[model samples]
Target: MSLLFAPFKLREVTFRNRIVVSPMCQYSSVEGMATDWHLVHLGSRAVGGAGLVITEAAAVSPEGRISAADLGIWNEAQAERLRPITDFIKAQGAVAGIQLAHAGRKAATEAPWRGGQPLGPERGWLTLAPSAIAFAPGYECPREMTEADLDQVSVQFAEAAARACRAGFEVVEIHMAHGYLLHQFLSPLANHRRDGWGGDLEHRLRFPLRVARAVRAAFPSHLPVFVRISATDWVEGGWDLPQSIRLARALEAEGCDLIVASSGGAVPDARIPAGPGFQTPFASAMRQEAGIKTGALGLITDPAQAEQILATGLADMVVMARELLRDPYWPLRAARALGADVQWPVQYQRAKLG
Candidate 1:
C-alpha cells in the first residue's frame, strides 16, 4: 500500500491518511464567529476525503486577529459556533483541527481583497510584538510587548486551547509561522529586546515555548498538539533551519506531536526559491536532525509528489494549500491516482466513473 493512503498515528489519534488540509485564512468571519460559509468551505473538504482538516489561523484573542474578519476562539459563543463545523467534519471521517494564532504586529489589517493594508485607529487597532517594528516599509509599526503582556498572551493561548477542546477539535496546531505573533518573537530581525523574551536564540524562543507549555497543560494528553514554525526567515542573520531544529527538539520535549515546517515570513523582501514543494527540505531536515515528526507545506500540488515526500521519509504528512482549494476532492482523486481504494461520498459515488 502507498504510504500516502496509509494510516498515520500521532499520540492517541490516528489519521486515516497522510493528506492534511492546510490552514488557509478565509478572512470571512463576524466578531470571530465561524459562519455558514466556514461550515461549507471546511465541510466539503472533509466530505471530499481529507484525513485531517485544519481550520484557518484562529485568533486566541480579538486583538490577535490578522484581519478584522479572522475567526477566533476567545469566547464561548465562538466555540459554540465551531461545534457544528467540527461535528460535520468528524461525520465525514476526518479529524477536525484548529490552528491557534496571534498575529501580533500583523494584526488588524484589512482582508486581502480590501487592499491588504493595515487598519488605522478608525478601522485598525494597535498591534503588539516582542519589539516595536513594522514588517516592512509602509507597514504599520507595532508596539513592543511588556512582560505583563507576554504573560497575558500565554494565558490567552491556554484558554484558547481549552475552548478548542470544548469545541470538539481533535488536533490543536499552534501557528508560529507566517510572520505572526509567535514568529515575531522567534525572529531576531523582528525581536529586538533586552529582556528575557529576546536577545539570544534561547531568549527569543522563550515566549513561544512558554505558550506551548501552557497550551499543553490546558489540553488532554491524548489530544495531539502541533506547532507550525517558519523553518527559515529567508534572510541573513535571521531565523533559519539550525534554529528550527533546536526549537523542534524543545517543542517535542514539551509535548508537541508534530512540527509543521514552513519558511520565509520575517522578511517579505527575502528571496525564496518558490516552486512545487519549495519548503519540503525544511521538514526533511527537522525530521532527520531533530528526530521529530513534521508536516511539509508550500506549493505541494500533485499526488505523486506528495507520495514521494512521504515515501522518502521527508515529511510525515503533506499539507497542500492552493491545490486543495482548487480541488476540494484532491485526496479522493489522489487515492485513485495512487491506485488505493478510498471511499467517495455516497452522493458523489454515482458520478465516479470506473
Candidate 2:
C-alpha cells in the first residue's frame, strides 16, 4: 500500500491521505472577505481528493494583509463568509485548514497583477513591522511597531483563532514563513531593535511564541495548531536550519502540533538554490533534531517525489503550492499514479481515465 494514501491523525483531526493543498494566495478577496472565487478555488481541491486543504495566509487584522486583496478573518463578518467554504471542504472528506498570518513590513502591497509594489494613500494603506525597514531597496519603508502594537497584534492572533474555530476550520497554521511579520522578527537582517523583541535569538522568537501561545489558549485542546517557518533565510548571519530546528522544538513545547518547514525569505538578496524538493532537507533536519512533526514544502511536484518524502520519513506531510494551482485534481491523479485507492466524485466518475 502506498504510504501517501495512509491516514494520519494530529490531535483529534484525521487526514485521510498525505496529500495536502498548500496555502496559495488568490489575491481575490474584497476588503479581506473571502468570495465565491475562494470557495470554488478551495472546494475544487477538496473534490479532487486531497486529505487536507489549507486556505491562503489569512490576515489577522487589516494591516496584516500581504496585499489589499488577501483573505482575512479579522472580524465576525469575514468568519461568516468562510463558513460555507469550510463546510464544503469537510463534506468532500477533506480536513479544512487555514494559515493565520500578519504581513508586517510586507503589508499594504499592490496585488501580484498590479506590479506588487507598496501601496500608498491613493491605493489605501500604511505598512507596519517589528522594525522600520523595507524588504528591498525600492520597497516602501514600514513603521516600527511599538510595544503596544506588539500586544495588540498578539491579541489579534488570538481573536483570529477564535474566529477560525467558529468558522468550522479544524486546523489553524500560523504563518511564520515567507518573510512576513513573524519571519521578519526571526531574521536579524530585518529586525535590528535593541528591545526584547529584536536583540537575540530568544528575544527575536518572543513575539511569535507569545502569539502562538495566545492562539493555542483561545482554541480548544482538541484542535491542532501548526506553525510554518522559513527554515533558512539562505543568507550568512541570518536565520538558518539549526536555528529553525531549535525554534521548532520550542514551538512544540508551547503546544504547536506541527512545523511546516519551508526555507528562504528573510532577505531578498539571498540566493536560494531553487529546484524540485530543494527545501526538503531543511524539513528532514528539523524533524530529526527538533523531535516534532513537520510538513515539507517547496517545489514538491510529482507523486513519486511526495511519496518518497513520506516513505523515507523525511517529513510527516507534503504541501504543494504551484503544482496544485496547475492541477486542482493533482491529488486524485497522484493516487492513481501511485496505485492507491481513492474515490472520485460521483459527477466526475465517468470522466476518470483509469
Candidate 3:
C-alpha cells in the first residue's frame, strides 16, 4: 500500500490522502469577504483530489489582512460566506481547513500584481508590530504594540477560529509564518522589543503561544489545529530550526496537532537555498526534534516528488502551492503515478488512465 495515499486521521477528521493544498492567497476579496472566485479556486482543488484543502490566510481582523483584498473572518457575515465552499469540499471527500492569520507589520500592502508596495494612510490603515520596525524600504514604520493590543489580537484569533467552525471548516491552521504577525515576534531581526513579549526566545514566543492556545480552545474539540511556522529566519541571530523545535513542543502541549514547517520571510536579505524540497529538512528536523507531526512545503512540485517526501518519512504531509495552482489535478495524477487506487469524480472518471 502506498503511504502517500493512506488515510491520515487527526482527532475526528480523517484525510483520504497525504496531499494537502497549502493556502495560497487569492487577493480577490472585497471588505475581507470571500467571493465566488474563492469558492471556485478552493473547490477545484478538492475536486482535483487534494485530501485537505486549506484556505488562504483568512485575517482574524481587518488590520490583519496582508492586503485589502485578502480573506477575512472577523465577522459572522464573512464567516457565513465560507459555508458553501466548505460544504462542497466535504462533499468531495476532502477535509476543509482554514488558516487564521494576522499580517502584523506586513499589513496594508498592495497585492503582488499591484507591486506589493506599502500604502499611505490615505490608501491603507496604520500597521502594528511587536516593535516600531519597518519591514523594508518603502514600508511604513509600524507602531509598537501595547499590552492591550496583544490581548485583543489574541482574542481575535480565538474568535476567528470559532467563526471558522461555524463556517463548516474542520481544521484551523494558525498562520505564524511568512514574516507575518506571530513570526515577527519569533524572529529577533523583526522583533526587538525589550519587554515580556520579546528580548528572548521565550518572551518572543509568548504571544504566538497564547494565540495558538486560544485558537485551539475556541475551535471544536474533535477538530485539529495546525500552525504554519517559518522554521528558520535563514539569517544569523534570527529565529532558527532549534527555536522552531522549542516552539513546536510548546504548541503541541497547547493542543496544536501539526506544525507546517516552512522558512524565510523574516527578512528580504536572508539567503535561502531554494530548490526542489529545499526546506524538507526543516520539517524533518521539526518532527524529529519537537516530537510533532509536520507538513513539508516549499518547492514541492512533481507528483512523484511529493510521494517520495511522504514515503521517506521526511514529513507527514506534503504541502504544494504553486504546483497545485499549475495543475489542480496534481493529486489525482500523483495517486495514479504511485499506483494507488483512488476514486475519481464521476464526471472525470472517463479521463482516468490508471
Q: lDDT for each of the candidates?
A: 0.92, 0.91, 0.92
- Candidate 2 local lDDT, 180-260, one digit each (tens): 999999999999999889898999999989998999999889989989999988899999887888799899999999888
lDDT of 3 by residue, 1-354 (tens): 888899999999999998899999999999989999999999999999999999999999999999999999999999999999999999999999998999999999999999988876689888999999989987888999999999999999999999999999999999999999999999999999998999988999999999988998899899999999999988989899889999999998998999998889988899988999999999998888888899999999877788788888889998989989999999888888889999999888889953
Of the two candidates 1 and 2, the one with more favorable lDDT, higher being better, is 1
lDDT of 1 at 156: 98
Pairs clashing within candidate 3: none
lDDT of 1 by residue, 1-354 (tens): 889999999888989999999999999999999999999999999998999999999999999998989999999999999999999999898999999999998888889999988787677888899999887765678889987898899999999999999999999999999899999899998999988889999999899999999999999899999999999988989999999999999998998989999887787788888988889999999999989999999999899999999999999999988889999999998998999988788888876655
In terms of lDDT, model 1 sits at 0.92
Instruction: In model 2, state the lDDT of residue 65.
Output: 93
Worst-scoring 10-residue span by lDDT in model 2: 117-126
Model 3 residue runs over 4 Å out of place are: none
- List TM-scores for all candidates, in order: 0.98, 0.97, 0.98
